[model samples]
Target chain A: MNHLDEKDIRKLTEETVKQLGSSATPELVENVVKEAIDRIQYKAGSHVIDTSPLKKAALQQSGNRIIVTAFGKNRVGILAGLTGILARHKCNILDLTQKLLQEFFTIMILVDINESPVDFDTIKTDVTRVGEELDLKVVIQHEEIFNAMHRV
Target chain B: MPIAIEEILETIRMTEVEHFDIRTVTMGISLKDCCSDDLNKLKKNIYEKIMRVAAEHVMVAKKIESDYGISIANKRIAVTPISLIADAYHKEDFIEIAQTLDKAAHELGIDFLGGFSALVQKGATPGEQNMMHAVPDALASTQHICSSVNVATTKAGINMDAVKLMGEVIKQTAQLTGDKDAIGCAKLVVFANVPEDNPFIAGAFHGVSEPDVVINVGISGPGVILRTIREIPDTLDISTLSDHIRRMAFKITRAGEYLGKKVAEMQNVQFGIVDISLAPTPVPGDSVADILKAIGLEDVGAAGTTAALALLNDSVKRGGMMASSYVGGMSGAFIPVSEDEGMIRAAERGNISIEKLEAMTSVCSVGLDMIAIPGKTSAEIISGIIADECAIGISNNKTTAVRIIPVPGKDVGESVNYGGLLGMAPIMGCSQLSNNIFINRGGRFPAPVKGINN
Candidate 1:
């Protein structure tokens, strides 16, 4: 009962087709079917689903997520220096983006540190030291603040 | 990215360059249960209660500040007004309790501990009167303790007797701390319709109805708003500019609410409201006056200053209401002459006067805040000023207060530098015009018609 079988997938697909009607396409059908199955599994396991975006963001809070931003005068070794520290600390870089504005280089990384052996303060100190060596402005803040300010 | 690059950069800029930070994370601990008939026992109960409950407040606030990479400027504590719990004691006993509170605050590593206060909007009991009388010594002898007396409210009108007493109290406090240019007066506030959960000092106190312990936060970011207004085109209309301010206020309020709740959770206390006051520091670009100037004023006391401040205050409240479920306290722009560099400059340049500041106060969060007058400005005139401010508060149905300092032996040209967050101000003069006869007729100023809306 915890998992969906073949008949359940067939039934969910039929319901998705009915809901879409004239707007249905192969891509839409496939996406809707996948979403339906995921929802069923999620509800079966968790017993509750968050509908409000603000509450969803709050409920997603944990020790795993953080945001790291670094910006300075464009330099060659900035990325390698930062990434090297993260790799050593076992900090998983979930998403990264870098851009250049005139003479400055701006980089932002979303990191997961739940698997790391070091605590938050130690990681922050290491990152700050590397930033000082490279002469860049770096800050690491918990992800909750960002979600609270911008998501809603 | 889960959070957009523009959003991330905006938050960083607000914190790093724009001077955005949490002004205070004040823990309001109820001490109603600490009351006793014996003065010694009462003092012990009050001291023990504060020390035990707020032991982790500073540590937790520091942790949260680091967690978010945003600075929390002051960690503070407020308690149930001492008069309510220790009314059985004498003025000297209250003074001793103030010392005890000061000691606990020092040990807890907090900047200021508030609630050596009394609420006498209509009248005062013997205990409340004693607490009021102890104001001078309590403030003069203690560094970390703050006190406030509410002499007026919308529904009950102004307590002229209490108002007159506070005038004398302010003078005595000034004289006692005269060596530091009347620094003691800076820690005392006279209020009308004071809020129960105000997280700002020197007016914060836990109200009787509040829970055992709760956390309230006041957010500070006048520089961010000023920069946002500067980026806007000068040709834009006032309404459009107001929308921009409202949006910015929403974001800041959300951040404050989140931080306050987390701090409360860490201490296992109930979360209180977010006070969306744009409190300013002496930093060059972080003045509320600069925001007013960015709104097209020639200077702070220019012709349309009042109108501009009204728009700024109203838009901030509107945006804050939409962002948080619980929004209270004085949620508007604070225009303290000593604390804001632009306001201090305007006073030094003689572009702003006390009368103009009073007019501006009718539309802002606080009234006549941190204004320093000359030494010999008579107590009757101070009473008169307090009465006029209370009248504005009563008729307008809003919170208003006076934190005036009559700096001893100082004239208009000299400025007293208290340094740090207290800032500095040129001694502003008040009219010596005699209101002696009117103030001498000391009685309750009747409630205004606006107070009878219900």
Candidate 2:
């Protein structure tokens, strides 16, 4: 059975015919048919809100998750130096993003310290010291605060 | 899935630009076991017990902040009301206990330690009276100690004797700490039906029913709420405005619940309530009065101020009640004149008066908080003010407090700056007429008929 329901398949088939006219026979149009199936499958699967409690439980059980942020004049090796210290401390970088506007550079890293052997205090101290050494402003905070302020 | 980049930036922007942060993480420690006939033993016991919790509470709070990239503004402690804890002591003079608490707080790096308190709603005990007497010297002598006296409760009615005493205590506190803009009085709050788990300073204390140790979170975000309203179309009326506020409050409260419970577990203490009050800071853009203004009031004490406060208070409670199961403390919109920008501006412009503030407090979270009054204001008038606030709390069967500091040398229009969370407040003088005869009639104000719903 196809991953998509009958209505989607019918609409997709009609589009295929409209695009290729008589050349869109099922046997000759294998590539188009496969493409349609894949598209339908992806649409059906994507954007489903994860309502599972297990995911939430796992997230919290992973001990501490913090955001490491650095702001400074755009300079080379900022990310490399920061991540190098994090890697040495065995911290897992879960997510990161950066923006460079004129001479200013800003970066935020979401890190999981549950896997890291270092305590939360030492990780913060080291990250802060390293960032300062590179002449960057740094701050660390927990993840739940963001979830609280933004998500209802 | 994962938190969106927009959400991350929004959080950072709130802390960086809007002054969004946790106002306080107050650990309510019970001093029930620290009682002794010997003052030295009592002090030693308190020192040890407080030492065990203070460093650890601050450590965990700092750790949580680092892991979250948010700041915990104040790390504090609120032990069991000093009067109750000192009941076993033979001495009526409890100043030593207050000094000990102040010392412990300083050594622990805690900002303020509440519970220099006496609950005399029904009547004052000899010991409680002595503790109350020590309030002025304690407040004058100590930096970290916060004092309070519950002069009324809905069930027990208002204790006029204690009210009369507090008038004198406030004046003495003002006189003693006159050099510091009467900062001593800022550290003392007079209350009716005060909450046990309030994490905010000047009024926080561990109630008798609370656990041995617990962490209560007061989540602050007046700026965030204001930003939410501004982002929407201006044509939106009160109904939709309330809906938006309620939703935002729910999310803000959830964050507090998550943090409070997790931090409590990590610290091996019982998790306390999440106070969902939109606590305004002195910092611009973070005032609860600004929230009222964004809700379409000309200012916090405008014509529709009380109605606006009622709406904001009710909406916040509706959202916060659903977000956390244990929503306790002063969970509404706070409108302290000094602490709120809109309030300070309105007050300074003479657009808001003491009468208007009193009326608004009937609807807001706390009552007449951080209000600076004239230094020469009589103790009778101070008692009169306390009586009025207590009446509101008793009649409504809700919590209300009076934290009026009569800055010793500053009269009306002249402001006082206590700095930090204790913001600058212009002096709002009270009625010059005497309320001495009424206040001197020392007796309980009987509880209202509505006080007995249960």
Candidate 3:
């Protein structure tokens, strides 16, 4: 893969402006050049040779799910304890992400709660209690990721 | 590029250069639990509850205003109708409750306290009857207390008995406070199809469905609309002017919605409805009648003014409804005679007659608002006005009310200045033709044709 440097990008913008003449406003030219650079960088930065295998795995996990957004300090075994309680309640973890803001970390978890007969309130209480034990703040909100992405 | 950022900032600054912000931010508190047989405890409970609920309103409102650069015109409180709160009490308890509310409002630094009211649309409850009996003395004794009575609704019909009683009460309230320039009756309103969530004073009351605490914002921008209209060229057609007005209303409502949501969020309370009514002030250029006159009318009651007002009201609602999801209360232009300098001028010149104002109410918002009639007008004639306004509301399925004060020693073409935001108004005369037989029938006017379903 090849990437366009700043000089090349500038040249492309000038040429596009010349072809479009005075019809192209400055804001329009800026938007076009920025979009082109983003596309080139995304293609150059990709390391995966195949994306289909990842898509197949994502499709197989389609079920009732909930997303929990927690904000607090990071700690050891925080994910394990959170997932451990969900596992005890027969809940499945679908996806998770943790980002650090200074010394504090915020975690967002996507979990499947379809296999258990327990309602949302029960799962929320269990996860909240686990968060309290781990000294983290947690909120569990319902989300149907599969339906949201596919139906809409 | 586009319009210079400096020009946009200048336009924004121009909006504030002479802008007198809304005069008040009134909270409608419900006093349902203050009823007691012991008048002293009832007064204590009423005072404590109002003080507790409104203790931080002025502080929070001031902080929010300073932080956000938006001015809050007034900080006041309205409670559930005092009659409802005094259900188990006597007439003396009503006066005690009113005095307590007035004292609490004064202590809390509020300009006016509302909900000294009675709802007697179907019939006067025992407590409502007692409150009615005490209204003359209660209103005369209190300085900052406001009162209202709802004697009609679309579903329940009008109670002629209640209407007749309110007429006498209005006369008495006026005569007792006549020395105060008729200020007592000025703070009273007689309404039909009244809303529960209205944030304006003299009529605001905490509705049943409201949260324990909430902040309702009434957005007023008659000045902005008037400025926009003044800039339009006379060559343009009426539709073009309507379009311009609608677009301006949309922008104003958008600003209001943004500010309302932010205020509710800061107050940690539910976001109540945005009263998009263009409430005017006594300021020179901020009158609704001025907006009407700006659209080429010499005065509010001039020919073609009603048609112009109908367009303005319709376009305003259409624009405001699109701007906000929860648009409620009196969401149209308010033409309060004593509250608008232009209206006062028109009435003084004999340009806007009482009948023309009534006709204007058919198309504009609120009916016969803040009108001062002559003291000699009979109670039967007042009932006739109530019947006419309530009939408009019942037939059209909208809110309509009358807050007419029978100014003593003032007749047609004579003006009295109540000063400040209450403004000044010329006395409009009513028909001397007797309606006593009709008013004394004392039976309910059946719900309008539209209110019935076979």
Candidate 4:
């Protein structure tokens, strides 16, 4: 399994020979190599994974913030369209995460609107009425809510 | 971290789904300086004073609302009681000043203007008698003006004469506005130990102790507290439950204080106090009776309701008092019937009665609020109710008030609708048993001597 890192390749190669000793045919060896490479490629925390995509600070920042949370049936263009509107409003995306499971799409984005120059009412109106614009249930909230609830 | 995304979502959910919001931002403007022997000059002076101090109230409030994310339910104004400043005015001339206040409030886009009021707990002076006589006319003439009469206090005892007069005033006011569900009565309140800095109408007023101009905020959070109690495990004890409520109150009071301070700072006015009253609305899911029911009562007026309310009120005060620096006003749960959907349902179901409500008031905040009785109910019976409530406040040294509306021509089981937050309520039955002989005796009920230790 050349695709597997030396650590996993060595462990898998040793396990294959030990588990299938004496009856370890060429066909079995080839199958083991293929399965090991497949598992290594699909598993979490892959050795060659590009982690820059997961690190938030790489693209996001924090400040005078509002959180945009949206939920709807999983469909194409949900993330892109919502982000596109935020972009158009001059709101900088501080952090964003989206997940689609069982035909349900839930997304949350932390945004900084200080640089936008647009009034808070416009942003608030856009967020609360996002269902009309994009067929999604959306809520916009200020960060003070969390501070009041969780912290002293 | 200062706050988490989850916490922000929780507060948003509370506002969006549970009906939590700031009850009011009342600007208390002292009218003591406008007192003059010339009635016309006094009226003009009062109007200009209110306008000068309140011109930017609505605009500034809306701006602060946008700056913060929370919504302010009402922008109201409270002024010094007119009786203190109307010593020279004739009884019949008081309507002109009431109309002037209405004009000023309407111009400022203020919803309620309080303090067309008199304090005669000790004795009614000529000025106080004039203001008291003008109650019905003042309320009947103005849409925004709210009037209150303080007829009792712990230190001064109950003024039975003023109490008797108010009963007639209420009846006359109801008769004048009989076509509109007697809404004039809804705008009037009778109080014992009324708080000067209360931001809640119709008992709000700027007392002599307060500054010239001040900002007071009242927080609404019965729904928020109810939601928190529901989240707790049922196996918990009263102490544990109280702790949970106190924590929630802390957060709610913090929000109110933050908003109040911001508005006061922006307006260059002194910040008065945060009234942590759990005011309910007619909207669904925003009732104090619902909280009582959730605390293990079959109905709001059932046995053990007062105990549960006491626990809730004590905990809310404990937490809210800790959150704000200067906590004042009616800082407890108010059981206003028409304004609370659950209380309305309980009353209609025959589970809640006037007597039980009186019992609840002993442990609750305001007394007999937003209640409606039959049109045929006599003024003496209303006076008896007010007298009983005053006795409770005087003995306990607590604030109590009565804001009952006797709808003209309405009978029991029929409902009266005042619309908006004033809400609709089934006409409650009062006792046919009259106390006219006792109430007719014009003398003060002496203050209870509470000096056992001395």
Candidate 5:
């Protein structure tokens, strides 16, 4: 995972402190910094994967965005394994949030594949495969469906 | 975070758990241009035209399903009413045309093709009469062909002669397909004030004024609304509960319109309308009757059922109208007894009777849908039943229809099971009272007063 630089963390903490007023504490600042880092992961992989047959076909991209959600038992290296496949395909992480409740883990990932050469179906199949390998249930859908239902 | 987490989860849960889906993406193709004096030429023209226009329909619906993660339940086709084009042909020619339509639908992998129909609200032309005569044979001989006849309308009143003919036609259809529990009657609808752009069958048809080629979508979500009502606290007033129903309807209709427009764009056709009908299936959770029960009725036949249904039907339209620019078709809550598990249970327990269903139809969408009666019922009684339903529709100026099947050799204690979406129907007893004197004295019931006739 790519971490937020100190400059970005400092800016986030300043805003958090202003919103928190006198309630702001060192521990709250630390938690805010961690959340900011978990919310975005960018510019991680420079190398691209070799071209496969799946790369030649393009998914009928809907606004070039996709939502990936996963739920399962919490374990180490789950995020690393999931993000590694996205990185290899040159997909950008627009926003991400992951949480561990008791022994279960849940994640919601917003990814933009405008920069990736792989088709939508290929990337989705790859991500679902990686999810299986990590012992998690996963679903990927176009972002427009969410927009149509939730927004005007 | 562009969409709130709760909204996203709600959408997912609706699709995955509540059975929210686009009920159908129906392609309405006009066959008026296919009319010909030469019978063979007419048949060939119809088959080719439907095949050409709907070749990509199923393919496009499947693509949108996977891309958006919303499942579409059915892909169907509707054509212009055959009577207009079959005026130059006879009953045999109409039967052949029906067969041709069945073949084309089968080739294109469509489940149902509607519009083997004749509109004789006032009176039937010679050709229209021939086509109506062909209905029993057309429906029995073909697999996927559905037929409907408009025998009454608000402006034209009730054509009792046409109604009498339809009564005979339905009995013949039932006898012809009696091996399959009189399944032929399941595909035939007799209507008063039927909407032309209705995407639901066996009533869907490309209207005379519609574009040459259009796509209409039917959206279904009784399960979603049932869950929404269940989540609301009973302490809240009815008005507040209606607001919640409206909001959920808004979301469901928006999703339907999006998918419909996207499919039309991909197919390079005009998008017609989104029919926001709360159509239920045989599945337990996806039931309009359950929604009525959830609205505080002990059962679907309880005293307050019609009021509860009226509230649900109106709120759905209120929310759906705001969500889409074009809203047409019969956008009411369907209470088909066989298709809805809750309704089936209600009927089985003797909780809902045919008379109560008729009264409920005054407020709900379609009338007397998927009801099975004893084989011993007379055609004059069937006509009486139909005339009564038509009277309600013409008086209220809303669409009403009857898809009642009189199962051959079956009685009130017996049930007919056709399986699949045409769920099992318990034979409900109809009034044995005779209206033969009135039916035999038929010409026209005459149009009702338009206003100030309470």
Candidate 6:
């Protein structure tokens, strides 16, 4: 509940004016002080008491999941190739998205690797090989799998 | 009160603009327990322990990457130095360990497995000698195994005997893997004052003092910084530009700190450093040179580029330090030749040279990374580059390493494509003047005056 006093606000305004110099308008100084106070409040626990429906809704979506990353050149049947591979491996592609950079393509496929018979290495090698055949580069990895392995 | 839609949109935009995400969440696991006089058992123990420990890495990395929508460039393992684990084993035993590590990394789906290393900064132990002897063959035969040899330190000084031996080791490693374009050398690095818990490899290793399990994160966002600088108005003064860079760095570091702490908490391990180096990729949009250009340079490696890099590196450290308690590793700009498209382009366009790159390393982090030299460049010249870079690190009291590729059948101006993360680089010329006389002196360079603290 502690907020910046009028004197503290005035001091911050002066500091802003000094920093901004010729560009500092009264309105600009006021805005800067307001933003600073909001940031301070957020850091100082004012924003922690979330009673909103949106907050409750957001908290519900948190859970453990898997991610599959694909990177390589954009080519004909890139997505089809990936889909076929995933289907053949019996990997349930939960959510899929792709981005095109220049002529290259990066696809991210979320899947349940635990239920899938295909291991990550096989998937990676197969995908990379498929990408190679298609003249693209590909990489597949699972989320937090590395940390879980070595980070005792 | 409910947040407005506009406010929510603004928050999303800010998050996206900041590129707030974890770059790498590396786990360092010790393998000392796997060591034994029985070579087969030692190799088996090493492989089993590594595979058991690293089995979950890919899954966890993928999960984290998805939850955060950030690309975790790699999931890697750094083990106890093989010398420590192979103390009783012979040279072939060390090679077996390397092959074992390569196999485990391959099977576990990890990108690179590091700590195929020897720490002989003062002098080589019996085990260290064996590991060093096995490096060429080990590196040549492995696919994902990475190796490092720390032959010097600030306190220990440069071990010239080890350096001399490493020069020949480099030659042998290059010669052994000549058919693979000396890809083995790409997996090798030599260093001074190397950090033990570095999350990046082939450099990462678990320090002796570190806990059994710990999470270290390396955050890279040259693209974000480059994009921000590109938005800067041309009329802004240098100070203003610096301020803008500082602000962007603050946001980037804060993101790294947030994710690092979260991951450590989840993993129930101590949170290690957040490496603030702007690690670049071969991707065109992710070029570090583009960052220089965004900061007002016409091209990277051009005039004023070194000074600009110094400023950028310093400001990043300043902001990152303010944002996180644990900030370490090569916390500066990275100028990897093959890994950075802009640097590669600069080298191709003849805007950057080996000498200028060396000068730039006096300010940047990780000197001379993935630089391809001509096949004809002597082992002496390669050693000379390593010596020069190590001197810079030892003098300045920082971590600097060299990973130079002596590309076969390639000369200055010709490009060698390494594909993937290794990228591509145009071979840069080296000096003809041989430093063999000085190099063959084979004596430790005394520690700097500043290092003589009682």
lDDT of 6 by residue, B39-67 (tens): 78888898888777667776776655545
Q: Which whole-number lDDT from 0 to 100 does residue B307 have in model 5?
A: 94
How well is each residue in B7-80 modelled by candidate 5, as lDDT tens digits? 66778789889999999999999998998889999999999999999999999999899878889999999999
TM-score of each: 0.91, 0.85, 0.74, 0.86, 0.90, 0.75
What is the CAPRI rating of model 6's predicted complex? Answer: incorrect
Each candidate: fraction of true contacts kept?
A: 0.61, 0.63, 0.00, 0.35, 0.50, 0.00
Ranking by lDDT: 1, 5, 4, 2, 3, 6
Indicate which candidate wins on lDDT: 1
Which model is ahead, 4 or 6, in terms of TM-score?
A: 4
What CA RMSD would you report for each candidate?
Answer: 5.8, 6.7, 15.0, 9.4, 7.4, 12.6
- For candidate 4, give the lDDT of residue B124: 93
lDDT score of residue B341 within candidate 6: 83
Estimate the lDDT of model 6: 0.74
Interface DockQ of each model: 0.35, 0.35, 0.02, 0.18, 0.26, 0.03
Give lDDT tens digits, candidate 1, residues B1-454: 6688999999999999999999999999999999888878887898899999999999999999999988999999999999998888899999999999999999999889999999999999999999999999999999999999999999999999998999999999999999999999999999999999999999999988999999999999999899989999999999999999999999999999999999999999999999999999999998999999999998998999999999999988888899999998888899999999999999999999999999988999989999999999988899999999999999899989999999999989998999999999899988999998898898889999888887
Question: Distance from true position, residue A133, model 3, in Å?
Answer: 58
**Clashes within 3 Å, all models in order:** 0, 7, 8, 0, 0, 18
Candidate 2 local lDDT, B1-454, one digit each (tens): 2566677766677778877788888899998998888888989999999998666888888777766766788888999998997875433357778888888998888889999988899997778888888889989889899998999999999999999999999999999999998999889999998887898888999999998999999989898888988888889988998899888788778777877787788888899999999999888899887888888877666799889889989998998998989999888888888988778898898888999889988887789899999999989999999999999998888888999998887899799987888888999978889888999999878988887778
- Against the native chain B, each candidate's TM-score is 0.99, 0.97, 0.95, 0.98, 0.99, 0.94
Candidate 5 has an lDDT of 0.89
Off by over 4 Å in 2: A1-152, B88-92
Candidate 3 chain A: worst 10 consecutive residues by lDDT? Answer: A143-152
TM-score of the A chain in model 4? 0.55
Which pairs clash inside model 1? none
